[model samples]
Target: MEELLAQIERALRIGLTVVVAYLVALWLASIWWTFRDIRGRTTDIFLQIAATLLVAVFSFPGLLIYVILRPPKTLAQLYEESLEEEAFLQGIQVHNSCPVCKQRVEGDFIFCPWCQTRLKRTCVRCDRPLMLRWKMCPFCAQAVYTPGSGEAQPQVAGGQTSAIPQLRGADPEDTGPGTRPQIAARR
Candidate 1:
């Protein structure tokens, strides 16, 4: 009977050793997973070390905690989102819109194409398109005469004057494509 009991005791010791070894291996795996997961999610050294230690200490429960608290988006996703936002902001900042018709217009456009509303006036000396409110021309440092500022109007064949504002290009004689309403004065 004593020999049989001694044999049973030896069998129990071997069983316990195997169980403990398996648990230790599983715990080590948990630690490694924690380290790898944290490294991929963040760039901070302290966070990676802290997560690894926590998972090692608590084993399975610590891994669950880290998974729940990690960032929802990956690094690549964050980068793409930032780029899209930057492009949208730049478009809003650079483009100019017409006030009368709310249509997008170029920077040097003298009048709104859709509304025929005079956006800017012609500069007297430099003959460049000037902004509506400016008293002086930016190109030639010359004073400008605003259209509605009660300036003298040259009469044609009869007493009628040119009511429609003419768009001048590089030279005063050159008239670019415009929807300017001009009346043919009778000779």
Candidate 2:
């Protein structure tokens, strides 16, 4: 009977030792997990050390408390969220853009401010801006005239002719004295 009791006590000691070792290993694992999780969520060194120590001292219960107080989103997730919000705000704001330079422009601008590309032509009769592709003015029923045509050209501000001068046949009547040729000089 005495020998049997001694064997039982020894078995109990072995089991107790295994349980203690397992608990210690679990406590260490919790500390490591808390440290890694806090590091991903924050950049502060003090917070990471505090979180690791909390888990190491109080084990699973401290880990639960840390989880409740920790930031919900990681640093990477916060950055991505901010980027998405910025893109959404940019999409919401509408801009009138120039086709040639893709720069922001006003609705009534005749030329792109950035590239100086001609956007519209002034109607000779009504002085309204007209699209290049339109055959006739929508505001006024006058027919639209394109450049290089022999018809009467449109006049711009300061009494300057807006059309590229007709160069097909030289008309002596068209080119009076002290006037340059109708040809466009290349740069």
Candidate 3:
């Protein structure tokens, strides 16, 4: 009977040893996994080493801490998000652009060169640049007229034609011999 009792005790001791060994193996694997994960997430080698040691030294609790506090995104995910934000900003700039022909114009241009679409026009009375479709000039209390409305003329200066609207009768024959032409203002 004593011999049977001793055998039973030995079996129990071996089972307990196996269970402890399994737990130790699990702890070591968790540490290794933590090292691998942190390495993949960061370019810093010191961070990887520190994370590995932190989990390894504390056994199970350190792994719990790492799991709770690790970065939500991978390095690739962060880079993708940055690229998406840049693309979104570029889209906004494109949306605010004016060139009707999709050509880029420099610095406050009144008309597009390719499509000839009037981007902005100068107020006839005030000579201030105003956007198209304004009913009245904001700078001066003058009636807004469309560029091609048969009453507005291109005022020229020093061999350069200005986009300043001039409320004049349509004179197709008179391209104007000089810089500016004094013409009759039609109603």
Candidate 4:
């Protein structure tokens, strides 16, 4: 029984050794893949290679040190940093137009000259004018303007009734509910 117990202890130690060695190799490979400089040799590559070698020779503690010393930057963080640099190099100014007359207006201006229409921009969907304080479109229940193509058009006109007749063809009883209205008959 004592001999069997000794054999089990030896097996456990060997298994642990193999697992530790495999983990060390995997970590080293990951570091190599992550920091491999495809172009000219970079400081990051050199540091990672050195850390990998240290971990391979020494083990878990060395790998722990490497992880603590250097961490990867997220894509969003890198993009934001680049944007900040660009904004710093090239100054950015926003241009706004008068809602009523569609005339160009200064970003700081509060009123418009051409239409004297309160210098407000109306929501294309609901035709409700939005204030500078609004974060969203009040009329259409949409988010604020983004840098893209022009606004979408509304399906129906507001407040005004059309002078044209409602029906452009024979009565529904004469034709059928599914039949399309005739445009020439109205003329």
Candidate 5:
């Protein structure tokens, strides 16, 4: 009976030592990780603490649960998510205006149904949606307009006319200069 008791006491001592070592290691690791990145969420910290405690107490099963339930986002993932959200918010339509005809158009329109004009264009630099008559792409400063097409005029480089000029109005000869004909703006 004495021998059995001594063996049990020895086992208990070893188990306690292991548990203490595990806890100390976990605490130190958590502290180190917390300071490394301030942007980590509260849920992440809580999960880490829970995972550490469970791992120390129950070993393999606890680790399996932690792995399965923990968030998949790394610092890079968090940054990407924020960037995507910002882009989405920025692109949200506050108002719709036709680029080609300079008319008010519906935001959901793929093309200007009235004039059969393509309202969207790819920016040369960023490849984002650019207005067909855009003098300079809002997202990328690429010239998208052409003269004589009633498109918005792009700013001349060095104030020179070397680049294609954007058309501001219909040809002067089409309506004789002396006619003084009434003109209606598209939008």
Candidate 6:
């Protein structure tokens, strides 16, 4: 009867030893997880060490506390979010600048306020602002006249100016794929 009691005590002790070893391994794994997770979430080495030590000292309960206090987003997630916001702002932002003075300007300004340079001209038919280099007003399809040139843009069908430039002395009636027409060049 004494031998049976001794055998039962030895079996219980071995089972307890295995369970303690398993718990220690689990505690170490929790500490490693905390360290790896904190590293991904933050660039601070101190925070990573603190989080790992917290789990190592207090085991599962410390891990729970660390989880509750950790950053909501990882470092990669925060960076990606910032990049997305920047792209969104750039897509909506309109960059306008004065060509003459190289200063920032509004999109609708016809003259540069800083240098008084004529940035655009007003369309005669539609009264909308047009760029100086535009040969015809896209809004009204009317020919834009140059301020000092002594020539006019030739009118095509529907009162729209022809984009094709005519030669110095080509006939207007010779407007075909093979024949080039002639008209006065508008400045």
Query: How far is each candidate from the true structure, as Cα RMSD in Å?
Result: 15.5, 16.8, 14.4, 18.0, 15.4, 15.7
Query: Ten residues in a row with the worst lDDT in model 6?
Result: 149-158
Clashes of 2: 0
lDDT (Cα) of model 4:
0.49
Clashing pairs in 4: none
Put down candidate 1 lDDT per residue, 1-187, tens digits, no spaces.
9999999999999999999999999989888877877777788999888888888887889888877887766667778898766544443224576666668887777778887766666665455776676765677654444454332331231122122223333443332222122212332
Q: What is the C-alpha lDDT of each candidate?
A: 0.64, 0.68, 0.63, 0.49, 0.52, 0.68
lDDT by residue for model 6 (1-187), tens: 9999999999999999999999999998898889889999999989889989999988899999999999999999999999876654432123466654567777667767897766666665466877666766777555555554312321221133223324311543333322212234332
Which 10-residue window of candidate 1 scores lowest in summed lDDT? Answer: 154-163
Candidate 1: global Cα-lDDT?
0.64
For candidate 3, write residues 116-143 as lDDT tens digits. 6656676554567665656555665445
The candidates, ranked best first by lDDT, are 2, 6, 1, 3, 5, 4
Candidate 2 residue 171 Cα shift, in angstroms, is 45
Q: Where is the poorest 10-residue window by lDDT in model 3?
A: 158-167
Candidate 5: segments with Cα more than 4 A from true spot = 37-117, 120-187
State in Å the error of residue 7, model 6: 1.8
Candidate number with the higher lDDT (4 or 6): 6
Which runs of model 6 end up more than 4 angstroms from their true locations?
92-187
Model 4, 1-187: lDDT tens digits are 9999999999999999999999877877755644442112334666657766766665666656656655465445667898866543332123366555557766544346665534334443354665544545544443334322222321132111111112422442333222224423566
List clashing residue pairs in candidate 6: none
Model 4, runs deviating above 4 Å: 1-45, 71-79, 88-187
| Per-residue C-alpha lDDT of model 5 across residues 111-186, encoded as one tens digit per residue | 5666666555444335576544456656533444433533242333212322322232344223222222332233
- Estimate the lDDT of model 2: 0.68
Q: Residue 92: error of model 5 in Å?
A: 16
